[model samples]
Target: MINLPMSAPTFIKSAEIYRSLRKKGITIRKTIDCLIAVLCLEHEVRLFRNDHDFLFIAEHFPLRIV
Candidate 1:
């Protein structure tokens, strides 16, 4: 549970999310943020962040952020 693995499907899912969000005009500034968002989406992990970007992302994508 310490080291999170980034496999092929993970990256693929990330790309998919990026494209979907992009199409919706939800521009995420950082690639890492997109990756992390995808990771949480896929794993059902709740994210605790105070960043506005994450709030915007959560609005479009289903994420439990606090």
Candidate 2:
């Protein structure tokens, strides 16, 4: 079961985004980066991250990582 605060809707969206990226052959080495990207994409939030993985994610997805 998903955490109720962020339930099925959010989980489904995150999973879908992740799957789509994977299907497109976008390889994100870090799972945390993928998770953060999905959350930011879904919520339209900026991510101030120094990890290069986040930069990779931003290139492929609509995530703003600093």
Candidate 3:
């Protein structure tokens, strides 16, 4: 798992992304979404989420979600 700051942006961003993806017919767990966000921010690794949340995060940050 990746580490992340306990900040509003992180939580809000994660939730917003999670909701969007949930609406898009993708399946993603909240725990996994949070992990992905942390990895993207901390490890600088690309994320691959079949969920809408990844798409949303990619739009704002430098991330490659496949």
Best-fitting candidate, scored by TM-score: 1
- Per-residue lDDT for 36 in model 3? 65
| Clashing pairs in model 3, backbone N/Cα/C closer than 3 A | 21-52
- Model 1 lDDT per residue over 1-66, tens place: 434567889888777777878898888777677778777877788888867777877887787788
Q: Which residue segments of model 3 deviate by more than 4 Å?
A: 1-3, 38-62
Between prediction 1 and prediction 2, which has the larger lDDT?
Answer: 1
lDDT of 2 by residue, 26-55 (tens): 766766666667667766777788787777
Error of 2 at 54 (Å): 1.9
For each candidate in the order shown, give its overall lDDT on alpha carbons. Answer: 0.78, 0.68, 0.63
**What would the per-residue lDDT of candidate 3 be over residues 1-66, giving only the tens digit for each residue?**
544456666667666666665677754545566556755765567676677766655665567776
Stretches of candidate 2 off by over 4 Å are: 1-5
Rank by TM-score, highest first. 1, 2, 3
* The 10-residue segment with the lowest total lDDT in model 1: 1-10
Q: TM-score for all predictions?
A: 0.79, 0.62, 0.47
* Error of model 3, residue 64, in angstroms: 3.5
